[model samples]
Target: MKQTQLCTLVKKSEPIKGVFDFTVEAPAIAAEAEAGQFLHILCGRGVFLRRPISICDVQDKLVRFVFEVKGEGTRELSEFSVGDKIDIIGPLGHGFYVDNEKYKHPAVIGGGIGIFPLLKLSQKLYEPLVVLGFRSADRVMMEEEFRAVSAKTLVATDDGSYGYDGYAIELLGKELMESECDVIYCCGPTPLLKAVQSLAAEKNIDCQLSLEQRMGCGIGACLVCTCKTTHEGMDENMRVCKNGPVFDAREVIL
Candidate 1:
């Protein structure tokens, strides 16, 4: 629970009009942060609860996060300048559990804001075939970053202004059909997750999911971000902040 400075706020795209990319400063957190871990953030002083954001890209001495300015807290976060600092507590929650040998030629699927966490994961997991879905061409983010790490990348837009003129799932199916991947991992809206889950189950491919749940405490103490899952033999409710923001696709009911 360390307080840090808001170092850089750069707009990545005019995508979705007001969304911005904030490359923040938190060396201590960055040093220890993992691929699927997230940072708990508080934009203004009076906001009692902090917002949980997935870690984006972390370089030496700095950790970055890309967020859409959906509300006042994020809007306020967008207003910070290079040197301005904010109170940030992270890297919270359990990260993605990726198999080193089994995940060779893994395919990653991300839609809209869900792409945030995968960006960091891609940096570590080299050359994954990535599929990103956006509302339009302008709303798209982080194409270049994917190119740096991914062996193959595909983009889909609702209005057909991008790489593929359809949903991300379309591209995902295509990627799966065209290539033989060892495993699959995905993050996005509930519908997209459901679709991916179904696909993974049908295909008999190992899959992992990162869940986005509302939180009171970024850690497990408050039981706010609970999800249903079957661990060993019984069904149980687990807190996302502590037990996992990441889980095996088969373990979760979804």
Candidate 2:
């Protein structure tokens, strides 16, 4: 199910420079939202296309999302006040696997803003080992939130300004050397995902990846957000907005 609604902005904050975190009073969207899904937000400043923002978490009748002001659409979105009604369509796209019974231990890894969607996933996993990466310590956001849900939370910074002086996947690799992770869920830049995919393949671990793509429509109607995918040895392209933002690492051609 999907919907286009005027969601009220109930909460707003700037976690870091150029990044906005908001929770909207969208009962309809919140009721059905799942981890890894996204919202297509209508930015009103002459921006014709809707912007896709990842779902951070859903609490009761509110749905939370975090987005960086990379361009005009996002910049306008950031300027919205607490009482404004924003047009949005969501609880959209396929989300990560939520069944945790079969797996004893699972790991969730993300870098920079990609870490947003993995929050709900970590909460759902009960006690996933979470590794998140950022450019520097000052740029890091929501460490305490992840810490509250995850059994152990590790932070990595590129310039050695934080916990570990390397990429997040590297920290995940170190953890895997000791811990028994039955499955892994990751989202980030292309390079990070590729590395994680390789690491998972080498260790023979099951893994899922959330891909990022430029989207025109939040639904399957537009073909702008397609990504290379393979299934049963057959190669094809799948829409990131509909078919998946989440896919098995082995099935994704990336």
Candidate 3:
């Protein structure tokens, strides 16, 4: 179940040039939040619709979310100061399923801001391999956090400004060929997700992907955040906010 509450902003940080990380006091949401879940945050007064931000981390009575200042909604959210009360509804959406025993050696991969949710996932998956990608060195964020939880970590930047001078998928593909991982968990831009999906399929590895989509209502009613699914012999649309932000890579039409 989800709850609406006025969460108090307890801490904030700018991990990168434009991205903001917020830790809020929301015990109810924190208690139930799972990796890959998100929060529907009411971004101040003028922004009527809530912005859906992925749950980045959860501690005793606090939940954290990170966002880049993309528009008015997120821009307003960034200006909020400590002790400000913000209305939020969460631990929303279906999350990544963590079955360590089933997927013995899993590789967790993400690109850009998509890496946020995977942080929580890495904490859950014991010593999973992690791969992260960024457009350049300035855009890179959270290298140490991922390294703390992962057995091995690889980073790639498109511009050759930092880490490997190539796409992160290239590193993932190389690793897949060299070693054996039972499954893969990934989230990122559409193109990256597609590449990862194709690679996973080629290798016959089970994979799961978390999708990002524009949303109106954070719940299922609005139908704004729909993605095609190939389940139950039907090629129908599924709600990203409700059915998932997470799904088996094979079940989605992306």
| lDDT of each candidate versus the true structure | 0.81, 0.92, 0.93
For 125-149, candidate 1 gives per-residue lDDT tens digits of: 7468888888898888888888788
Candidate 1: what lDDT?
Answer: 0.81
Candidate 3 on 130-183: residue-level lDDT in tens?
Answer: 999999999989999999999999999999899999999999998888877988
Provide TM-scores for the models. Answer: 0.92, 0.98, 0.98
Comparing 1 and 3 on lDDT, the stronger one: 3
TM-score of model 2 (CA atoms)? 0.98
- Give the deviation of candidate 2 from the true structure as CA RMSD: 0.9
Candidate 1 lowest-lDDT run of ten:
6-15
Tens-digit lDDT track of model 2 for 1-254: 56689999999999789999999999989888899998999988689899999999999999999999998899899999999999999988999997679877999999998999999999999589999999999989889999999999999999999899988988999999999998899999998899999999999999999999999877988799999988778999899999889999999988
